[model samples]
Target: MLNLSESINKTLNNFAENTEMMWNFADDATDVLLGDLDTEIASTPYEIVYQQDRVKLKYYKSEAPVKMKTPLLVVYALINRETMLDLQPGRSVVKTFLDNGIDLYMIDWGYPTRKDRYMTIDDHVNGYMDDVVNYILKREKVPQVNLMGICMGGTFCVMYSALHADKVKNLVTTVAPTNFDTDQGLLHSWMKSVDVDRMMDTLGNMPGDLMNFGFLLLNPARLMIDKYQSFLENMNSRDFVENFVRMEKWIFDSPDVPGETFREFIKDFYQGNKLINSQMELGGKRVDLKNLTMPLLNIYGKFDHLVPPGACELLTSRVGSTDVQDVCIDTGHIGIYVSSKCQREFAPKICSWLGERDGNFSEPEVSSPVKKKTSKAKPAALQN
Candidate 1:
């Protein structure tokens, strides 16, 4: 409808504006990508209450008045640092629990070295975990404490709770793979073909980067391709860039898993699929899911590829606890713990669950799991 000259001028002006907009985006992106931004994680203030070998117990002293009788011990997986729980100020799981008047304690399984290659599930569960629980109980002067675990730590908690139900007032596990018979996860499929014996013998410890790459392979398009693309697309935003970098740091900060421990977990849990059936063993003792008779809360991510719902949901049906509950969060593995959307639900749910269970304990038994006698404990060998 316009004259030829007018139409041409209009088209040129539109093109010039588009070009300028892209240039502005590029400049802002450069600033975001290169500019200084704080990426520090686990910045919540805590005192190291107990230390033995590479492991240290972090007791988060809260300013808020305490309401619960039992102090909580947070056990994280050996694969990564527990810092994920306390990544930043507002997003910190530790802060959330503290703000809610829950006394909290966490285990920092520090980095592992070559000498840790021979450590096994027995050592972790019976040696370090038991000792840690003993330390917390002794320090807090409580007979039993609430124990919460994530991923591998959850598996350990299950094992511990099954063996020592009297020590744990309530049990909580998030995104923990229990029944590993399904084709719901890439790790399940790939681990079937893996030569864990050769890998452990040759490498001593499984590299964190290698394990991380395997996780990335689970969804190449989303994790490998699209995530970076999204970052690039939103690189101009300082907050976005800072959050992205923080996650990246956490993801890559994995520690080499101890060789024997890796071998046992891969063979026993991943390959043999023993935990659900009450067939796994640790430290000359048997690990029976039926032995987990404490008040149980099994939490899992619905979209968790690493540990599908099939892997987690079976725990409630299998465990011996009468007061068992399964909380299926509507998010992925990491997002269930740290996503802004999940932040309001996740910690509050856990705190409420624990608060309800705090005053409602079964009749007191003469023997308790958390009351193990420890005159002086030695250092555990491996790091996280």
Candidate 2:
């Protein structure tokens, strides 16, 4: 009887201790939440050197002497802003390239509105992208520039390079979905049946918020529930809070996609699987894979849920480039750019690869000052 009484007392003591700990945690969390925190992202400095319509071009000059005579143009998807590459200083892909003596230019597909609803895939790939390339070539006095694309942007780059092979010196694509026939990802399956025509007709431009909601539904356990639970648990840590908030800012800053472009992308790329088969067309010209004869480097995340390896691995086989290489990083979609492990692998590999073929193309003319429309703004996105 005495032992039973002691056991009951111990149980009550444990419960009281847990309650006290919870109160202490709550107090600490409140302090952290209320404290001033620096959560700014895309801190690496850059200049908006060019703008056309709603799209802008960002230029990041290398502090070191430019090693590659050919400058690189990075094309990010219209779904998300280009800020993901320069997310933070220490872990920035932009910083890595700059440190390696690479002169970088990235496309900022600014927020679209009702006016942009009629814009088609041809308008982006053969129009804005083509103009951007021409501007870069003229500004740098180079006949050809190195090309890199990410996600949907990568798909655009593939199309661009194919159509205008003469302007591209070397081509690099990361996590770019080309083959859409496989049922490897949830997006692949869901996009196949997506009634994009109806959605676009009703909404004009595909709403950024609607896209974010759909992405969240892709993996709600991790993206929605557990993510917030982790934030709650670690809210007292300033570092955790700052990083978490920064990511939140980036993820939610989605831009609306032009309706015609979205409709064509869904029908031609995802449902019809036309790109890999060489049946896709832009500006009335067929996007033949055989036309991608420049030096090609295709990189993709092995475990990417959105653009799986199955979608990426087929490009090297179909491209006409004799010099082709494929790299599969062991990570999910966004992790390939933001994770520490990828920091050492992703940008450096490109720098080295480009360095090898930098001299293989038409040499850039002597450096000269060129007039440009310069502006600056917060490097965040409207979508993806």
Candidate 3:
């Protein structure tokens, strides 16, 4: 019996050693395969429609152009490029909206340069955003425009709508953070504790790479390790490999945020929790949530690590809009916009929601010539 036990132990040790060796070999092979896939994926053709500053606005054109009942403007976060909306032909939010007869205009907050170091939230929300909105109003000859804000862009859109209620008909916010007090979001907690002044002083412009690294750290086991393993197992499949590569390109293609904007964002929004509290101010004007009276649709993700349901739900209570609805989709932060599952459920839901509200949509009437006021009302700050 002793001899039999010894033999079994030896066999088990040999098996364990062999398994380790196979794992090492597989890891090496996966590295090489992924490297190749990355190169191929980065080369995929993406058609971006408009360019403002360093920002690129990519859209998937509809096969048949249908005149949308409402002209919609989409504002994406400045942290990353806006390609996530139009990731691919079939899996595109913009395409889905366009196909559903929504005329879309997305803001590309372009790459911030050294000169843009002092660019504040006001600049984005008031300056550039105002210009874009006015341009759309003029081009379409519309009185009021529908505004859609995603993530941080949603926060900006909310502010913009509040300050310029006359310019906006309806507002839609997807995965936008309004309450930073929620503990469910790891990113918000980190931002709350961060010394924005020191960080900005240390780095004139907040490095995009650093922000990307933080996002990766949020789900290291999944994003950094498990994803690679899955890629290797499915490397032989061309479609899978191609899709993987495209996602990787979109993931790594991050843009640097301006320093002043970063400083105010951390202090005012994340740390102070000002937006919901109505303590936030932009360009010397207080950002009162009560000022937002237009119809509002707040879309949130149930499992979003970045902007949890709690963070987004706060908007419904804070905003003065009587006609407000909250939609909670079962998806993660990025998955809400890009994943195949969300593409079917999330995108279509937005289209339907907007369509239902189309009755409220009205074009801005041409103003009759009048004596100009001594001073025009100051535009809201441009920061999204």
Clashes of each: 2, 8, 16
User: Model 2 off-target regions past 4 Å?
Assistant: 1-15, 359-384
What TM-score goes with each of the models? 0.89, 0.89, 0.81
- Candidate 1 Cα lDDT to native: 0.83
Considering only N, C-alpha and C atoms within 3 Å, which residue pairs clash in candidate 2? 79-383, 79-384, 80-383, 80-384, 254-382, 254-383, 255-382, 255-383
lDDT of 3: 0.77
Name the weakest run of 10 consecutive residues (lDDT summed) in model 2.
370-379
Per-residue lDDT of candidate 2, residues 280-308 (tens digit):
98888999999999999998988898999
How should the candidates be ordered by lDDT, best one leading? 2, 1, 3
- What's the lDDT of the predicted structure labeled candidate 2? 0.86
Task: Give the number of colliding residue pairs in candidate 1.
Answer: 2
CA lDDT, every model vs. true structure: 0.83, 0.86, 0.77
1-384 per-residue lDDT for model 3 (tens digits): 459889999989989989987677677657656665433321223355556676554433334344556688899998887778876665677766666667677777877887789999998898778877877788679898899999999999998998888899889999999998888989887887788899999899998999999999998999899999998777656567767877888888888999999898899888899999998888789989998998898888889988898899989888888999888877889988877656666666666557667853222111111102201311111011
* RMSD (CA, Å), each prediction: 9.7, 8.0, 11.1
Cα deviation of 376, candidate 1, in Å: 48
lDDT of 1 at 343: 64
What does candidate 1's lDDT look like per residue over 190-244, in tens digits? 8999999999999999999899988898999999999999998898999888888
